[model samples]
Target: MVLLTLMAAVTIGIVRARNLFAVVVLSGIYSFLMASVMIVLDAVDVAMTEASVGAGMSMVLMLGVLYLTKVEEAVPSHTPWLPLFVAVGTAAVLLYGTVGLPPFGAAENIVHAHVAPRYLEQSIAETTVPNVVTSVLASYRGFDTLGETVVIFTAGFAVLLLLRGRRRSRPSDDA
Candidate 1:
């Protein structure tokens, strides 16, 4: 409930902030809070990815864009009812789905009995890491990590290319 409230506030701030920097910072905060919620949900891998991509890389990219362009711009408001309707409808569906979920940490669920146990049992032997999550990410699912690294590198390269210089000011013709 608290997480949902924080998410809503951060989203509102991101939408309403006049300064680009403030919007970016608010988005980063939103990402961080989302990551925390993911942690609470026992989705550490997703949380890690979200933290790195959202709070870390995206914030840097936003800052770079802000440096290249002025931080403030005149914002025009438009009819927001369409988005409001969509958001409310989506939230309703999500709430409905949440009611069907197994209670947290229920041992009888298929997740604990089947999927998670295999990792807990085999990962130590397979990867020699006491932490199953680390072992899975670094060893078992290495290819996916490599792909994510490549994507991050590509994003950084693209940002660099896009922001590569023309002088911010033009010299006077008299000079």
Candidate 2:
């Protein structure tokens, strides 16, 4: 409960901050808080990934980008009513979608009955990996991991391209 409140406060701070540097820092804090929540929920693997990727590497990348960009955010010329409405609507739809799902931590859930047992039993024979978690991530779900990597790579590449374009369009310092 304490972590959740801190996370909410950090999210509000991120949303309210006009300073880009502060936003970046707050985002990292939010990520760390989320990782802590994951740990409390007993998802240690997810927590580690969130801490390293979300709080660690992502913070470094955003900070480096900040050096090339404005420190403060510019005020928007128009209201964000459409975006706000869209976000609320999306949240409603997602919540509605989840209404039919089993309660959290229910051992009789579909994944527990079908998928998890298979992974525990067959992972070694199928993937030849000693560690079940490693086998599931590296072999059983290899394509999903690759897809996530590609998405991250694509986003980073897009940011680099945008930065390059902005640099090229600016007047040279030598002039």
Best prediction by TM-score: 2
Task: Write one digit per residue (lDDT tens) for candidate 2, span 1-175.
Answer: 8999999899889988999999999999999999999999987888999999999998988887787667989989999899999999999999999999998888888768878899999987898887787888889899998998999999888877766765767645211
Off by over 4 Å in 2: 124-130, 143-175
Q: lDDT of candidate 1 vs native? A: 0.83
Per-residue error (Å), model 2, residue 30: 0.9
Provide TM-scores for the models: 0.71, 0.76
Q: Model 1, range 64-153, lDDT digits (tens) per residue? A: 768766999685688879998999999999999999889877778766776678889999788899988888788888999899899989
Stretches of candidate 1 exceeding 4 Å from the true structure? 1-4, 38-53, 160-175
* Backbone atom clashes (below 3 Å) for every candidate: 0, 0
